[model samples]
Target: MKRFHVHVVVPKLDESVRFYSSMFGANPTVLKDDYAKWMLEDPRVNFAISARGGEAGVNHLGFQVDSEEELTALREQVVAGSVEIQDQPGAQCCYAASDKYWTQDPAGVPWETYHTLGDIPLFGADSHEKTVAGASSACCAPAVSIPAVVQRKVGCG
Candidate 1:
């Protein structure tokens, strides 16, 4: 099984939490100082919001798979279609460890497909690591472009 995922960056955590909770008719399943997540069964979506001081609006969209096999199948589909992707295996982000593949849609919206492995105490375990291009890694999302070497290593175009 897979759940549709949507992450948004907000300016105010408390206000956004209040608004979303009222709209969803339930409180978030996971709430932190700067983040909140609602695992909504009604819409079968994993909707999350954060106040991380970034640009406000949709942060990213994704599919959260239940198992590694499902993740692999999704990855294979992306590869078969020859889409450019950034693969992050054993990534710890959004308070969870996951294996993820990221790609941009035709309109340039970023999308992620991942399988969660477990929870983590931090928002992102490797938040400080520099990418192959020497740019600081974004906490929950990949940079716009991955280095060719990394793309080759991940077997993604």
Candidate 2:
């Protein structure tokens, strides 16, 4: 199964967390000082919020696949569609490490499709990502021209 993903950049983390928790009727599955995530089965969405700069609105939308086969199929479809893609293997972000594909939709909205590999302690895209060519994404947000996000901490390898 593939879960829909939506990441929003907020002006205030706690405030947004409060609001969304009220709306969703549950606490976040993952919560940090500047980030929170709700892996909700009701809507089957991986909804996340972070106070990591950018304007207060939707950061990016995506799909979180369950297996490597699904991800490979997705990548094949993207490649066949002629959409430009930035591939990140072992990417650290959103308090988790993932294999991600970054691209934009027809309206140019940034979209990420990834398969989470494991969790990380922090919320920043670490220096290890810099090793991947063209992998300049920050923590919890797409590197594409989605919006102006705050610079990530350096050397968090």
Candidate 3:
């Protein structure tokens, strides 16, 4: 089965990890000083965090497979194109699962290829885990706050 992958670079790896852990109900399966990741199965996605160049958010995104057989097939396909396999499957990781691999597109963006036979618990989309509150900042500030009553009056009720 085909699945989506998204990698985001963040300023604070720990905050991002906590944010996603609360949002997705799964902690990073793999984490290090420079990187951390969540292999979430319910929605079939791989979320990656990286600390490089001081940049933050969405490094790349692609597909994640479901089995070793699937990974092998994709590895062959990737190798045939003369692309070196960055990370092979079966490598030890931190949180839920045990193995994963990494690949890259022609543009040099990284895409994670992995399978989590051991599933992790997931949260609903509307879970309080997510930070919907936009923070005040220089580049972008939060919009005017409205009371629940005003929200209801505006048909957002």
Best by TM-score: 1
Task: Give the least accurate 10-residue stretch of model 1, judged by summed lDDT.
Answer: 146-155
Tens digits of per-residue lDDT for model 3, 28-141: 877777567776778877777766533565655656676788877877776676665444333333223424545555555655566655532321111221112432211111
lDDT of 1 by residue, 1-157 (tens): 9999999999999999999999999999999998999999999999999998789999989999999999999988887776777778888888998888887776668888999899999887886643435567787776656322213335657
lDDT of 2 by residue, 27-142 (tens): 99999998899999999999999997888899889999998889989989977766677677777887898988777766768888999999989786585454225546566555
Candidate 3 displacement at residue 74 in angstroms: 1.0
Off by over 4 Å in 1: 129-134, 146-157
Candidate 3 deviation (Cα RMSD):
17.3
Candidate lDDT scores, in order, read: 0.84, 0.81, 0.54
- Global CA lDDT computed for model 3: 0.54
Query: What TM-score do all the candidates reach, one by one?
Result: 0.87, 0.85, 0.46
Off by over 4 Å in 3: 12-44, 47-54, 117-157
Q: List the residue pairs that clash in candidate 2.
A: none
For every model in order, what is the number of clashing pairs? 0, 0, 3
- Cα deviation at 86, candidate 3, in Å, is 2.4
RMSD (CA, Å), candidate 2 to true, equals 9.8
Measured over all alpha carbons after superposition, the RMSD of each candidate to the real structure, in angstroms, is: 5.6, 9.8, 17.3
- lDDT (Cα, 0-100) at 70 in candidate 2: 93
